[model samples]
Target: MKSIDPTIVKKKTLIYIPKLNRRQRTIVSTVFAAMLLLAIILGGLLISNERITTNLEIRNLSPSLEHPFGTDWLGRDMFARTIKGLTLSLGVGITAAAFSVLIALALGMLAATMGKRIDALISWLIDLFLSVPHLVSLILIAFTLGGGVKGVVVGVALTHWPSLARVIRAEVMQLRSAEFVGISRQFGKASWWIATRHIFPHLIPQFFVGLVLLFPHAVLHEAAVTFLGFGLSPQQPAIGIILSESMKYLSTGMWWLAFFPGLALLIMVRSFDILGDNLHMLIDPHRGHE
Candidate 1:
């Protein structure tokens, strides 16, 4: 019988490991381009010395050179307000998503890697939270906490963690029985050391995709709560507040007041969603195949 060469087998196996190629590169490039363009526009607005003064004469004006995004009912510069609102929305979305994911990661890891009773308790809590209607729970929390930006942030962060926790729990559970985890256990490696050294690297891609997906939802939820009068104050210039105020002028045919803001919100949400999808595909080639 011929002796099999182990080195040759190892080399062949390693050669088959998937990696990003030209098509993946193109997709990543496109996504980055969109994000970069958005960043540039937002940065310019943030740093520009030019003030956007509100003019009553231009109030509710349609999109034109003088007022690119048109003017709001309050005579505020809609273009400037939209930029500022986008910044605020992005800030809240990123911060809330990050906080929620961190909470989820910590809780989920504990549940997956800790004692059985502890896991059971955390799992039960997660299930209980999931059973509640997220939006309604957020609204109640915001109202109880005294409605404003801070209230909205807390409410959204609290409501957002369950889904991420479930995802992380599922990932951890799948990983716990894998060969590497079992080997680490047999070697008496500390749980935290094994998790950090072996598990976290695997979890990072999924976590990032989750983070991106969370962004759009967080922004939308914040806007919705604000629109319903349980979130940011109207004077703060949030997109939701703008939309809420625009409702009164709808019957009067000042459609631009609502139209532009609504369009801006839709565009932003869609961008984030697309970015998330692209990221998911990039990070998981199996997903790309689908």
Candidate 2:
């Protein structure tokens, strides 16, 4: 065989693979993050029930070969309890986020498309909600609703919508002046028909991204209220309850009770926050170049 010339070998080494565009990279990253999140959620769901089973014989054990997160005072596996509580929290977060997004969409559209009086009223309401401290409002709402899963859900749903609704309102206002919207109106299409057919499609990305971004807030608030005895029931295996129970045992030198559960919750919350930020960058027309 003939030996390749040195120059030809150098040229071959210079061949290039095209880099991914901003959109393509965002798509890949988003999918990977989503898959990881789903895997964690599914794992938590699968092992949650099994881990909560109690055994008095093994109660108050420290971390060992048999138990990584140690045992609670009641002999329940801390790892199992943490995972189960996380799953419960994730469920609450998702439900609350969905409800909040729906509220945002409706109010956003109304504020953008309706008369000036309605617009000003919605704007004032948004400002009013934003002015209050988030946790305090959530506690009050949750308590008023009877302080359980329903209370938490309603509280979160009510509190999380204002920011996203404001964003949607701005987007709809822009859409109102677009050429297509004006043409549709000239054709005698009713306001609702034009909104449904012309404006709503453009808002789907904002809606979805807003929904995801609301999740971490919902989860955190749910935990906070529950920890304060104003959210989920104490008997339920929720992150808030787990952390709340851990507080009493921490002074007894049983550090694992709070450490594992709180760490897991922190990880889950941060993961969702990163996921939401990534999604916002992906969906926003002006972002994701970096």
| Candidate number of the best TM-score | 2
For model 1, residues 178-244, the per-residue Cα lDDT tens digits are 9989998999999999888988888888778888888888999999999999999977768888889
Q: What TM-score would every model get versus the actual structure?
A: 0.84, 0.88
TM-score of 1: 0.84
- After superposition on all CA atoms, how large is the RMSD of candidate 1? 11.6
Per-model lDDT: 0.81, 0.89
Error (Å) of candidate 1 at residue 83 is: 1.8
Error of 2 at 63 (Å): 2.8
5: Cα error in model 2, Å: 20
Q: Enumerate residue pairs that collide in model 2.
A: none
